[model samples]
Target: MTHRPRSSARRGDHSHGDVHLHGHGHAHGHDHPGHSHPTGVRGVLHGIFVPHSHDAADSIDDAMEAHSQGIRAVKVSLVLMLVTTVVQAVIVAFSGSVALLADTVHNLSDALTAVPLWIAFVLSRRVATRRYTYGFNRAEDLAGLFIVLMIALSAVVAAVEAIDRMVSPRPMENIGWVIAAGVVGFLGNEAVAVYRIRVGRRIGSAALVADGIHARTDGFTSLAVVAGGIGVLLGFPLADPIVGLLISAMIAVLLVGTVRSVGRRLMDGVEPELVDRAERALGEVIGIDSVDRVRMRWIGHRLHGDALVRTSATTLVDADRLASTAEETVRQRLPNLDEIAVRVVAVGS
Candidate 1:
């Protein structure tokens, strides 16, 4: 019979013969799980008028803050898109521009895209219950799925409108109004696109970033509308429907990219650089034998990870300290880390 050596440090109670390390005095409760700014003039203005911008270079401290940033971006973008759509709709009625009508519909869809994401972020704040041990972080990913679907639907609608216009050519009226409305759509969508993408990257939200890309596609289509209006002014009557078809084709291409991105996130894909960062941070810790494995994934904009490490056979107390230090190192190096589990393995069994 073979016997494994147990040090005096391991004499005390243990679970599965592995030391699980956690930071001392660390709070286990959800941070910013259900937080909101006080309702008043400030909150309303912040929610509507002021654009909330975030920098990708900055580190996010907690999950609640991350979710708030995403919500803020979505809210502001939604408002801007709604206003753009209203203006375009008015023009569409007067000018009878099929291209402008399609752009307006797409812009309205983009505005509504914020709703699912907002709900997802809000749901993410719900405390973990018995039925949901992981909390509601996955809601964000689910919302991402909705965003992809909306993008697909918009493409289909645009294509159909374009095809209908092509089959029965109608004289487009009020070319000036169409051009102005197209300009307005371009500006609105472009602003939302930049804002959403910046905040999304800052908060580590793949879904928000995907939506931002979606808005950027709309902006380009709006520009195409402008081109079509010019073509009409130059006496090319087919220009309106032709540009609409081009816009539809471009949207289809974007849908492919959006699917891959959202699908990857849903499948628990993460950037390789984060794994490298974890290994590097663990390696730099004192008394670590080797970092065997590091796995990380995004739950909403929050990051969670598990790491396995090997260390020299030592007192259980020392092993615990080594593990704790590793956890701290990782927390300091990585942004938006909600929780990290470190398992310590003794060297040579």
Candidate 2:
């Protein structure tokens, strides 16, 4: 939120592996290894395309990659949502259960949220003008907020439907079809899981990975509701309302968790893991006597940070080398870093 740089403001500023194979493995603390530092025109293309490199931790750059990754993810999720929603609606109609109907409605919103995010991704790619120095890095954040809002509203509706069903239990019909539909939805959820994990790792996006986790959990929750439907048809008719209550509780929990997550991102709460890794990386930078202190956080999927470093109190030329070397080293550590800065601190007070 603080503008740490300006036209003349020389104010200092501040992943992949197995992402190719499976749910882009957990973002390791290790920096990117074996990156081909491009030169001449290659460097420009590198800077333009790779998104991160030595000193590539600019805010706009981080946002750009996230915007691009968000688009790909939205498209994949959109198709999956559409496919699952149709199945859910058909099964819910045949089953005569509001719980299933509500689930169908919730699935439909996934597609709705993706559309706007896709648009934001497109808009975010534009070059920043004099008017906007950050070049729309916040676009993904806005789009992210929208997706979180949709999740909240869908949970609310799901909860309300569950309450209605609990009030007047409907004799569920076509139990087999409900179970079949739930199975289909669970499959779709796995598909989402696969896509999100793979792409998230490739791009190093925690948000997309989180989305995958949400989808995976939603599948089980839907399955639980389907089990209730089947049980109702098999004689324990009260099971329908009982599972409905459970689904309501699950929805409420998911809603709260999702909102809290998005709020944290928007409000700028740094992740502890990133902070720890940053501290270690800063310590490793060549010529850096000590890191002194580090402040790192997420901007979308991209990481941006500033470090107040205590050097050995070398000369001016040595100081610049120390600062740049430290910055570049930390930059290499985080493949998705958009901006990273190291401020020289004299050892003495």
Candidate 3:
């Protein structure tokens, strides 16, 4: 049922060290022939220090490490947002500031959003089994969808609260407390935003990055609350609701970008720049005549690629050299490149 390459049929005689490669099947101890692999002490040292490994156990270790880093970011942000919400809730009780209440509610919801991502990261660490060959990596993306939904829901809640305040204006108490709470909200959200965005980008997680953006938006909304308080001080009774409405509008606008970003990842879209980088790396290999195709995608924060390369090499040995070289080149050039499948085709074939 499977078609074998003509070159593979002739590769039955090919051997790497003492292991012979069977016809039409490339299965071997090593990923490629003539590839110099770490042995004994060097392999152990590389595994301990570098953390990246070609072995299954080592790969799982790396995956766990990546997930732990993401979880740390979420935990820290969750704590900060919770503290901010609690402080604002206390101020709301004394101030009766509808604008402050709306922001506080949004902050609470934002803090809860981290829970799903935390669980997703945990689920993503599960080992691949027969039923789920790709493992649970896509759990992160699904969690991202949930985050986007939560953000949209927050926008709607903010809108409804704003509209209600506009229709029936109420006297807000402890205006100074409302101002102080706004400043506190802004500081907390901003700090979490900076940390989340930095960690998210480092781990290459679209979900985490979107959550970071959401936190940044929350920071701006907190600023809007401050502006509303100032407007009330300036004798504009409707300013509180108006600013809340503006905050909702800003969130709605940002939702579109997050949707597009998360949707692309769910659909297996890889950045063009990453593909270009792969192609360039493959092209640099001495025996590779041309890079025919390069396809890459992310599974969680890890990257995998498949490339077809045309080689000018006249013999099987030269072709093996091309394949090995291309693998090494991409591994060196790309960050978090988990694995790559390179197909070697003879020139003009």
Candidate 4:
């Protein structure tokens, strides 16, 4: 749902440093003392030589960090989806199944869509200049939309081919080969789909999650293909186009649903239920007088936002302590929170 954006104004701003961990998993050292000094050429030179893990390294432009594990999973997913698509396309061509060829073209589009999604993730982390406000927060959302579009386009092309087949039926010669290839593809994609779903959600990236679920959808479609191949093997001619049509329908429905969800987010839908929960949980803390207003948006699946509160403006010292405490408190309350910001405002009568 939606909750206010939260920023982790944690410890110190870690710009560039060597963060070495001890054997026991303790912060051994974080040395960036000279990195703060304005060294024009030397800074750039040191940066090039420094080896920072993607998770460890701050984006040169923005502080919005991405989950390295999740990104890697998508890259792998793209590779698998590509391979399977090719396999299906080849099968469809040799068997003279218009339905399979159409599905193949759809898969090709899915592979092409990955390029922009990866590019957006890298670009979204860029530091915001005077020109672009709110950073590139929606880049991930944009990528998610592209993925939905890719799936939809594939479904449409597949459906058209199925219709053509229905109008002019063609006999498939090698039903056995089609069935065998499809079974292998079916089991392979199903396994990858299941793994991607969990990994994507853990990292709170919508595109990754969507892609994972989409893989599952592909698994079902493959199953449908297998069923169609079995029908062919059994000497049922009409079953091929009929099953293909059913699979096409399922894909189109899923695609439409995906598009709607991403569209609402892009249009700025408020997820107030999450914000209310955040306020209630934070209010339980001793110093927090009342729940201010919490505003939230989807930074992937994680809720990111600011909680505006009306505190007793009397004691500045206690107030700062109270605000920081509340911010940390809220963070622990939710698993999907990336950054939480608390703004203290005095109630004016």
How far does residue 288 in candidate 3 sit from its true spot (Å)?
0.9
lDDT for each of the candidates? Answer: 0.71, 0.58, 0.70, 0.56
lDDT of 4 by residue, 1-349 (tens): 1122232333221111111110000011111101121135433322321212232122111123344555566687778778877777777767786545655665555556667767766765565556764556578788888777766765676577668878998876566766755675676566666556555545445576566556656666667667877887787887877887877776765555456557756766534455566777678867556765676666544445666666654555555656656755665454445455566555551
lDDT of 2 at 343: 65
Better of 1 and 3 by TM-score: 1
Residue 93 accuracy (lDDT) in model 1: 85
Ranking by TM-score: 1, 3, 4, 2
- For candidate 2, lDDT tens digit of each residue in 1-349? 1112212111122111111111101122224312234466544432332234232232223444556666778797878878888877877777777656756776676546667656756765666567865555456567667766655555565566667777876766567777777787777876875676456545544455446545655665566667776787678877766675665565555545445556776787665656666777678866667766776555555555666666664465566556556655665456555565556655663
Alpha-carbon deviation at 260 in model 4, angstroms: 3.1
Q: Select the stronger candidate by lDDT from 1 and 2.
A: 1
- Name the candidate that leads on lDDT: 1
Clashing pairs in 3: none
What is candidate 2's CA lDDT for residue 90? 78
Per-candidate TM equals 0.81, 0.72, 0.79, 0.73
Model 3, runs deviating above 4 Å: 1-62, 93-102
Prediction 2 TM-score vs. true: 0.72
Q: Is candidate 2 or candidate 4 better by TM-score?
A: 4
Candidates 1 and 2 compared: the better one by TM-score is 1
Question: How many pairs of residues in model 3 come into backbone collision?
Answer: 0
- Which 10-residue window in model 1 sums to the lowest lDDT? 25-34
- Candidate 2 vs 4: which has more lDDT: 2
